[model samples]
Structures are given as C-alpha cells and as structure tokens.
Target: MSQDLYELSATELSASYAAGLDPREVAESVLARIADREPVLNAFYVHEPEQVRRDAEASAKRWASGTQLSAFDGVPATVKENIPRSGIPVPSGTALANPPVSAENAPVTDRLLEAGLVLLGSTTMPDWGMLSSGVSSRHGITRNALDPSLTTGGSSAGAGAAAAAGYGPLHVGTDIGGSIRLPGTWAGLVTLKPSAGLVPLHAPYMGRAAGPLTRTAADAAALMSVIARPDIRDYSTRPYPSMDWFKGPANPAGLRVGLQLDAGSGAEVDPQIAAAVQRAADLFAAAGAHIVELRPFMSQAQLAGIDAFWRTRSWADYSALEPEQRENVLPYIARWCAGGKDYDGVATMVHYNRFAQVQQETIAATRDYDLVLSPVAPMAAFPAEQPMPVDDPDLPMAHISFTMPYNMSGQPAATVNCGFMLDGRTIGLQLAGPVGADDKVLAAAVWFESVRGDAALDWARVL
Candidate 1:
C-alpha cells in the first residue's frame, strides 16, 4: 500500500479518495517514506509529522462530507525554506540560532493551503539563496537522489531533492537566477520559472519568481493555475486574465522555435548536454514546428551586468544582518556579498542600465519566434559540497550562462529532462517565451514531454 501510495502523483492521489482510499492513509504512507529517506537525502529542513497528520485528517473529513476545496485537496507538497508558511521557521537556509517562525503565510503558501494541499515541510536552500550548488552552512549539503556524491542544485536544493526522492509529486521553489531550473535539471524533473509578477511576490526584486518543480510539465501547469491567481498584497502582480494552464495549448503544430546551441561566449557546454537539447529541437521540428538556429543575443558585458546586479542585491541583504549573524553565513556567499561592497551608486546604476538594454535585446532577438530552446545549464550536476563545477575560483558564472539571460529578461522559461549523461546525471532542455507568454512556453514543454515519453519519470522512480 505504501509503495502504491508513493507511486501516485498529486493529481492521482487527490482522485484516489473517490476510489475509496482515505487521505489520512495516504498521508501516513508519505510520512513513512520521508522517515525512511530524509536521513540520507537531507531534503527537508523542518517537517512536523504531527501537524501534517492533523491536516490530513481534516482533509479526509472534508472528503467524507463532499466538501473538498480543489482537485489537489489532500495532496502532499513541499515548500522552499525561504517562503513563509504560518507556524514554520523561515530559516532561509542560514545557521542562525532560533530563527523566528513565520507569523503568516506567503502568498504562494496561502494559495497551496487554501487548495487543501498538505504542507510536508520547508525544504533546504543555500544561505540567502546565494549559490547554485546544494551545499549550505545551515543544513550541510543535500545529496542528489540518483547519486549521493553529486549535488541536487540550488537555491531550490532540497525542493528538487525531495521531489526526486519521491517525498511528493509537487514542490515549490523560487528562482532568482537558475535556482529552480538548475535543481530541476540536475534532479531529472520539470520546473517552471514563471514570468515576473505572475506569482505574487512580497517585496519582489529583479529576476526573482516563485514556481513549481514536478515530475511532469502537466503537473507544473496545474500548480501554476492556482498560485498565479490575483493577490491584492502584491502591488506588482500583473492584471493578466487567468487561463486554463493545465490544458496548455491544444497542440504545437505550427509554432516557430529558435534554437541556440551555444551562448557565443567562452563558456563551453558539455557535448552530452548539447546533444540532448538538439534532440529536443529535432522532436519539435518533427511535430511540424519551424526551427531556426539563433545567434547569441547577450554579450559578455551584459552577463557581467546581470551578475553585478545580483551581487549588489545579495550584499544589501547580507550587510543588513547583525555582525555576528553575518559571520554564520557560508564563506562563498559572504565573499560574494563582500565583492559588491566597493561599488558606488553610479557603478550600480550603470549595471542596471546595461541590464535593461540586455533585456530589450533579448526580447527583440527572439520576438520573431514563438519559443526559444537551449540547454538549461552548460553541464550536468557537479560534485556535491562545491560552489561550482569549474576548477577556476574566479569563473563562478560559467555554469549559469544558459539560464540567467532569461531571468534578466523576465521571460517565462521551463526546463524539462531531455536525457542523461554517461555518469548518470540528467540533462535539461530549456523552453522559453517572451514575457507573459508563460502558457505558450508550458504548452511547448508539455508537447515535448508527450514525445519524450516517461524515460525521465522511470529514472526518478529508481529511488
């Protein structure tokens, strides 16, 4: 029964109640799975089994009374640590002692809870979400579900790990750069970084968006429909009308796609990763979609500008911490924060201006195409507990070359598991669309997933 419960997706689990399976029984199976796996994967930072059981019992009662809230009622889901959930500590992946618990739920959390999705716990992330690798000073490191020696990627580290390890079928993670995609790519899952303002963000910053990491693009679309609903709290929330994201596009029979194999910069992509992306493009071409090779739209200077913006923003957060608390942060994160201390207002503004120009160029370059395709990262997951894959300590941006450009442009982008490397690491093919074309982007992903079949799904279940 536990094995059968573990195999069910969130959508399937929700429907199981109608098939005579109690939500409480399913919840117990999930808790038991976590108890067996959490010690090795380190996927969750804090989970209250008692609280989860109580919520499950309530959901079962609702089911018995024919008062379920949504299709996801009684489904298990995990939230990233940085997002606030009432009564859970928002550690933000830091080692600070007795971090204050959240007094209220973040907008995303509220939506999930209101839908009756059971909160499993908060997942781990790098300190202040500063690094792409899974290592963190607060919770040590999150190991890849496929291989214990490899990283799960970050700052959505544990969310990816939890999803890959079969803790649940739905998980939420935030992406400022490649946080969600990086982990999704490494963990052989599908993740979407919805366009800016699609998901209500409190005190939003440039390039930051909250989204889902799941086993299938269809599941991501389902979660997005609920979370992207209008919230009055986020002043920046777009007034866009809601659509049936779960249905995606009816088909991708006549879409135009632009493909870029390399960034035209010094960063090199692994052959396996590039091949996987090409295979995805080929699949689209076979589906009657027009595919054109595109030149790099972003320059080295533009990339540097984006990096500077993030560094400056991170520094501001780090510098605001109490001196002793600052010392508790990961050394790499601290160093990154310190690197921005010397920048004057003028220099920072110059970077912002450059970033704006880059964003415009990116939009204009891909405007003719319905979608853009590329590798999610330059390579697969690297060694666990490391900051990056490169031997050079100075080139921290090497692995992020492919995904960060979309973040700067505020476009909707998603990464789907396309294939795997010889060393057992997964490769992700990225699908991106212009700002506010999130549905189109996800539709293309779903179409590709249909063609790709369930190879990645089978791999994920290897646990």
Candidate 2:
C-alpha cells in the first residue's frame, strides 16, 4: 500500500497482519505520527510510547505464532480520559476532582484490551464533559487536527483529533448529548452513539453510550463489534443477540428516509450544513429511496427544560465540592452550573420530566421512517479557544439541538462526512434510527460512505 502503516484503517491493518506484517513496525509508525502531531493538537492526557511498543511486541509474537487474539490485534487505538482503565486516573476533564486510580476497567476498555488493540492512551476532554468545545482545565485545549485554529468538538475532543491526525485507527468516546457526533462532524470522521445501553458503560447515565470515532464507517463497525457487548456491570445493558456488524451495504432502495432540515430550537442551521444535508437526501433519493421532509419534532421549551435539568445535575455535583475545588473548574462550566443552584421542587420536576417528553416526541416523529438525516451540528467548527459554539455559558447548548434529541430518545445516531466548508472545515451529516436499530443505522452509514465519493481530504498536509 502507498500509505504508511499509521495511515491504514483498522480493517486494513488486520489484513496486513494476517499477511505477515509485524505489529511492532506498525506501532512505531503510529508513535512517530503521535509525536509529530501531539504538540499542536494536545490530543492525549496519557501517551506512553514505551508501553505501546511493549504491547505491539506482544501482538507481533501472537501473529508470528498463528495465535493472534483477534483480527484487530495490534491496531492503534485510544480511549477518552473519562473512561476508566484500571490503574489510570479518570479526571472527568476537570482539575477539581482528584480521582483515585480506578480498580477495574470500564466495560469499553475491557472490550478494547480483550480484542488486542494497542492502547495508545487516554484522550482529552472539556471540564466535566459539559462543553461541546475542546477547552479543558486539566489537559488544556485540543485543537482540530485538520485545522489547528478551529475547535475539535467535544467532550470527545482528543479522540476526534487523534483519529483525524491518524494517531490511531480506533478511538472510543462516550456520548451523553452530542459529544461524539459533534466532534465527529467537525473533525471529519465516522462516529456512532449507539442505541442507549447497546454498549454498556461503567457509570451509565440517561443517554450515555460508549462508541467509536474512526475515519470510515466500516472501521466504526469493526470497533463496535468488540465493544457493544453485554456487561453485567451496566444495569441498563440491553439483552441483544450477537450481530454481524460488518454485513455489506444496506439496500437503500425502497427505504423511507426522512430529511430533517429544522431543529426547531437553538441556533439556526448554517447554509453550508443545511445544503450538505439536502445533498445527502438527494443522493438517497437518487439511490431509489423515498425521501420525506420531516417537521421539527423538538421545541424550544423542550430544549430549555432539558438544559435546566442538566444544569441542576451538574450544580449538585459542584455544590458538593469544597469551595476551592469548585473554583478550580472552568469558569464557563461554573457559570453554566450556576443556573442549576436555585431550582425549586416543582421546577426541578418539570425540567426532569422533559426527558420523557423529548423521548416520546422523537420516537413518534420518526416511527414512520426507516432513517432520518440531519446536520450533526448547526454550524462548522468554531474557534478553539472558545468554550462552546456561542462562547457564552448562558447559551452553552445552542449548537446541540440537532443531535441531543436522539440521545434522549435512545435512538442510534451516527455522523458521517458529506461535504466540506469553503474554508475546509468538515460538514457532518447525521443519520438516526429508532431505538434498538443500531445495525440499521450503521449499515446506512456504510452505504452512505460508499456513495459519498472522494471527500478529497489529505491529513498528511493538514498539520
């Protein structure tokens, strides 16, 4: 292959290993790439090249003896800093909490290690995983690899940068709201937020799931095949059968695909992103699928209510901290949590109830369609120094309206690059499906990847 080992996809690396390529060599290539890019991107909180080399040596031995643990045995990969790996401290993107080293691996980490992936290190995230931008108090800002001045959307900030910079073939990120997809959008990658509980997590929340960020949808599916397993640890884990996640392109012909151009709340969609989504819809229609225009299913009241609930949840955590520790938090995050401090019982209950309402509305609106297409975010990547798209703590969530509803609804959602902005930033097209439709959503993503020909990106020259 013309590309270097570090540039290979996970599937490609697997094949090369099967053909007798040594994992150690691949490991060195990735280490060099990381060293070259890390200074500007600041993508990882932990990156130990010696440890990576040792793991790669072991994988090389396994391959040499015809006893490779898995097809992905030695492929480079990263986990978000928030996901605990036994013996590693999870800072949750804040400097305030001095977390003890974890005694056990997060379920996602267990699966990644078990599959024999070379653990590159933990990636950076924003304070408390609250902001959509990459600014963090603990690890500093993670810039977009494609364009350093721009934000690598978070809280999957570093994971996005790592994947885009070819630091690895697989990166695990958790999505509660739009964390995974938003970064995937701005960073130009394939990312998934599985149906809630489909990928069991360590400390599961309402809409959080562990998923992959890779350059290709197929690579995302390859990573999903390992991580989306049942773990007794997550009470919310769904009872799902083992799936053939790499099944070929889904037949789009005769499928009913919904086009959602309006989020109905928050920031208005940028013209470039809106047009890109429409182009995606046109491609689906051209491929023989029925494209239906969808009415906005979410309202500003619903968005505000959910925002209020989140603020309180975060404030509760902040209020419990010592004053100095609380002061250590990012100022933007502090301001955002301040709104949660004074909610009365009635107001709190009303805000909490919005989740059920949002969920119900999302499911009801999409029940008639096999898939729905929309923009992953309202606009392209923002300034890296900013805390959020709007740069206002009071309006921190203005850009998440398009991607947050699916998290509440527990639907499977994905972001795939469909186009690019004139300034060269990526425009992500989001594809969502009804709850329990992980396979369908992923398959559709793969199909789209095949049809969305030649994105014309060159990461080699990006830096």
Candidate 3:
C-alpha cells in the first residue's frame, strides 16, 4: 500500500482517500521514501515528518466528512526554497543561512495551503538562484533522476529532481531566466514560466515569476490556477479570470505554431536536440496545426544585451553583500557578478532600451502564431557539479538561449519532455505564446502531451 500510494498522481491521491486509502498512511509512505532517497538525490533542504503526518490526519478527516477543502486536499507537493512559507527559513540555496523564518506565506504558498495541497517540504536551489546547474553552496549538487551523473538543472534544481523522482505530483519553482524550464527539461518533467505579471512575485527582480513543475500538464494547470491568482502584495499583478486548464484544447487543428531551430546566437544546437524539436514540430503539423519556420526574432547584439541586464541585476545584489559573505558564493556566480560591476548608468539604459526592443520584436514575430516551439536547451544534461556546460563556461547563457527570450518579453512559456537523447538524458520542447496567453500555451502543451503520452511520468516512477 505504501509503494502504491507513492505512485498515485495528485488527482489520484485525493480520490483514493475516499476509496479507503488513508491520508496518514500515504504521508508516512512519502516520508519513508524520502528518508531512503534523500541522501542519494539531495532533492530537499528540509522535511517535517511530524507536521506532515498531522496535516495528513486532518485532511483524512476532511475526506471522511465529505468536506475536502479542494481537489488537491491531501495531495503532496514541494515548494522551491526561494519562495517564503510561514515558519520556513528561505536560505535561497546559499551557505549564509539562519535567516528568520517567514512570518507569513508568499502569495503562491498561501494559495497552495488554501487549496489543501500538503507541502512535503522546501526543495533545494542554487545560491540566490544564480546558476543553471543544480549545484548549490548549501545543499551541494542535485543529481538528475534519470542519470545521477548529470545535473538536474537549476536554480530550481531540487524541485525538478524531486518531481522527476516521483516525490510528489506538483512542485513550484521560480524562473528569471529558465530556472524552472531548464530543470524540468533536464529532469524529464512538465514546467511553466507564466507570463511575468500573471503570477505574482515578491522578489525584487523584475522578470522572476513563480510557476509549477509537475509530471503531467493537467497537474501543472491545476497548480497554476491557484498560484496565478492576483495578490495585493504584488503591485504589478493583473487580475486574470479563472481557467479550466485541465480541459485544454481538444486538438491542434486550428493552432498556428512557429518552429524555431535556433535563436541566431551563432551557437549550434546539438544534432540530437534539434532532431527532437523537429520531431515535435512534425507531430503538431500532422495533427492539423499549421507549422511555420521562424527566423531569428532578435539579433545577437540584442540577446547579449539581455544577458548583460541579468548580470547587472546580479552585480547589484552581490556588491551589497558583505565582502566575507561574497567570498562564500560560487566562484562562477561571483565572477559573473564582478563582470557586471563596470557597466555604468548609461550602459544600463542602453541595455534596457535593447531589452525593450527585443520584447517588441518577439511580440511582432509571434503575432501571427498562437504559439512558438523551440528546443528548451541547446544540449542535454551535463555533469552534475559544473556551473555551465563544460565546454562553454565563457558563454554561460548559451544553454538557455531559446528560453531567455520569452523571459525578456514577459510572455508565457512552458517545457514538455519530448524525447530522450542517445545518452538517456531527456530533451524538452519549449512552447512560448504571446503575453497574457498562458492558457493558450498550456492548451498547446496539453495537446502535445496527448500525442506524446505520459511516458516521462511512467519512467520517473521506477527511478
């Protein structure tokens, strides 16, 4: 029963409580599984077993009384460490910890609690959500579920690893530049980076957005419907009507998808990844969607400007840290930050102007299409401990070339596991839609999942 309980989806888990499966037993099974696997996977920063059991017992009562709070009642979930939850210390994956526990939940955390999703614990991340690799100063490396030798992609590293390892059905991760999508792609999971203002964020950064990483598209939608609600704390948030994302587009018959093989950064895609993206496009084309090949929407100069903008933000944060505290940071991130310190106000404005231009061009390029498709990363998962792909340390953003554009445009984007590489590492197909078109992007993802089937979820269960 314990093993079987661990295998159920969030929807399945909730339904099972009424079908004679005790929530307490399910919680214990999850705790036992975590105890056995945490040392090897390093997927969690903390797990409160006693608290989890208490919550499960209460949830079970709700079920017994036919008073379940929501569809996710008693369904296990994990939140990325960067997001604040009441009583949880958000170290932001850094060595400098013992930060005070949050007094209240961030909007996303509050919604999860309100929806009755049982949080297992906070997952790990890179220092200050800095790097794409899953290695962090506090928790070390979060290994990939499929191949432990490879990285799980970060800074949403632990969330991706936990979801891929079947720790739970839903995990929340934050993305500034591909944090959620990259990890989800590398870990063979479904993830979304909702349009910037669609999901409220408390972070000081402008582009960062919180979203869901799950095994199925429907699960991602379920979590998003709750997390994307407007919050007064986030002044930038805009009210969006509730959506039924589980019932996505019935088919791709009327969707227009623009397929981009490269972003014109001069970096070549690994042949295997390109082939997989092509296959995904072919599948959509065959399903009655009109597929159009897209040219580079932004020039190399514009792309580089976006990279500089991110580094400039990092520089501000890093420079403010005490000198001793900075010394404890990852060398790669520290060096990246140091490089940005020389940019003057005029240079910053120039980059901002370029960023705006890039955003305009992206919107213009996709105006004719319902969504755009590309490879989530240029290559498959690399070694677990490295900050960037071993051969391209100087070009740190190369791996996220296809993903950062949407982040800059403030458009919704999602990654779906398309197929596996010859080395067994998974590849992801990225889907990006116009600003405020999150539902359309998700609908297309669900349609693709229908075609591809839930093979990734099935594979992860046995890992």
The model with the greatest TM-score is 2
Clashing pairs in 1: none
Expressed as tens digits, the lDDT of each residue in 351-429 for candidate 1 is 7887688778878888898899999888788888787666343444677767777777888999999998886678898
Clashes of each: 0, 0, 0
lDDT of 2 by residue, 150-245 (tens): 999999999999999999799999898899999999999899999888998899889888899998888999999989999999999988766678
Cα RMSD (angstroms) for every candidate in the order listed: 1.9, 1.2, 2.0
lDDT (0-100) at residue 61 of candidate 2? Answer: 94
TM-score to true structure, per model: 0.95, 0.98, 0.95
Q: Which regions of candidate 1 are displaced past 4 Å?
A: 1-3, 98-100, 248-250, 320-323, 391-393, 453-457
Output the number of the lDDT-best candidate: 2
Model 2 bad stretches (over 4 Å):
454-456
Of the pair 1 and 3, which is ahead by lDDT? 1
* Alpha carbon lDDT of each predicted model: 0.83, 0.90, 0.82
